[model samples]
Target: MRRALHAAPEILANFVAPYGVYEMLAAHWGDTDALIASAVPPLLWSFYELAKTRRVDAISVVVVSAILLTVGATFMGGSARLIQMRDAMVTGVVGVMFLATLGMKKPMIFYLARATVARGTADGAAEYELVWERPGVPQVFRVLTLVWGLGLVVQTSCMCWLAWIWPIGRFLLLSPFISFGIFGLLMFWSLGYIARRPAARAILAR
Candidate 1:
């Protein structure tokens, strides 16, 4: 609950505020402009997070990269629909990155989990590093990474298909809900998966 409270500001900035911005501006500024304007909140939030942390981490890189991609796509001057499709493209790319890391010594989820667990403390970070060496820990992260990668890819595909066929207003109305739904399911599944694994449970108990 404390973590959830701490994350509320980011959630509002990235998802809620952007949608509100687009809705408020779309009528006056036009879709392309509104889309570009809506990117501001998340971009600002990403930079703020980076500044607050004063250290680069996997999650920070992903958030900043995704925001930059969105901004770049908007500036490319395509139709509003194309701008809307930018989120799908960014998500797909990140999903691919997750899958690509499967070949590495530690998968993408390992870094993400480590960052979350450490919470900016050196001792916590060191503890997680030591935990990584435990038997089954590596495999757990790999499996979690695979699940998240596949889930994100599927979500991106769905978003792209919707953006392609639906009208801009309708797409905008539904996309956020779709994103939240998919992500919520993925997170729920991850918690359940971790709960079932003794190694993962040990990490969580720490």
Candidate 2:
């Protein structure tokens, strides 16, 4: 419960704050400028967290990178639809990054899962590192990485197609719901898969 409370600010900064900023500014600034400006809260929050913690992790890098990429896309200055489509590009890029990690000794899921399990404590992080050495744990992370990578890619494709066909206002209205739905499904599947794996269950028991 304490951890969840601690996480609330970040959740609001990343998700709610941005949308609220965009809505507030969009009428005056237009979609492109409003879109770029909406990135400010999360960007600032990310830097604040980084400064406070004096540490950088895979998730931090990804969040900051995605914000920069989306802001950059807005600078391209096309239709409002184009600005909306930038989100799909960001997700697709992260998905590609996830796939790219397959070439490394540890997949991206290892770091992501570690961050979740560790919850910012040095001792907890060290313990989760040891969990990585357990039998079959590495393979589980790899498979999860693959699944998540493919899922994001598919989600991006669908979002892009929808953006292309739908009006800008309609797309913007529905986009968050679609994204949340896909992400929620992926998370559900991942949890169930982890639950069925003995090695993953061992990690959870810690």
Candidate 3:
């Protein structure tokens, strides 16, 4: 995710900016065609990336939301601030989804982790099903889901605040770093928590 986010600016500069392929086409063919052509590939690629995984339900939500945002941004004109909001919107929706899953059979993280292990390891999905039913497992995932859901909401609010106050160029450049920083922090915290969590440790030890 970090690598992909970092590469985006370069991709835009190289392929979509002035004298770049998209811009060159836009110069002759016009903005609408250029925009569609430029956006479709990335959108399709995003879906393709998600399709490679087995977690269809969660993956579908992410990919669909992304495509909707990309399309919305495309037609919403080229304002950098609005683009930033659109990105935040995706985060917000994802956050809400995470929270909503607290009422479901499993939290979002459980499905995500299970799918990852299932796809990456032999017979891991069945083991995951068994592990998921163990004592204390559901509560842990529910708490985690709540934390991540609220965390994402907070992250989105911060991004929106920055977009409101900061220059577009600066926001565009700095916002990703802020997000990466949050993600890094959360990742470290999750790792530490998991290391100390007997249930998580037990699952892994299997």
TM-score of each predicted structure versus truth? 0.85, 0.79, 0.72
In Å, residue 21's CA in model 1 sits off its true spot by 3.5
lDDT of 2 by residue, 57-115 (tens): 76667777887787677677777667767767889999999999999998988887676
The best-first sequence of candidates by TM-score reads: 1, 2, 3
The segments of candidate 3 whose C-alpha lies over 4 angstroms from its true place after superposition are 1-48, 51-57, 202-206
lDDT of 1 by residue, 1-206 (tens): 99999989988886688778888999999988887788788778877878888766777778778778877776887887787787677888889999999999989888877777777566766688887888888888899889999999999999989989987666766787888899999999989988888766755644
The TM-score measured for candidate 1 stands at: 0.85
Cα lDDT of candidate 2 equals 0.80
Which prediction has more favorable lDDT, 1 or 3?
1
RMSD of candidate 2 to the true fold? Answer: 3.4
Scored by lDDT, the top model is 1
Model 2 ranges with Cα > 4 A deviation: 1-55
Report the C-alpha displacement of residue 183, candidate 2, in angstroms.
0.7
- Candidate order by lDDT, decreasing, is 1, 2, 3
Query: How many clashes show up in model 3?
Result: 0
- How high is the lDDT of residue 6 in model 2? 94
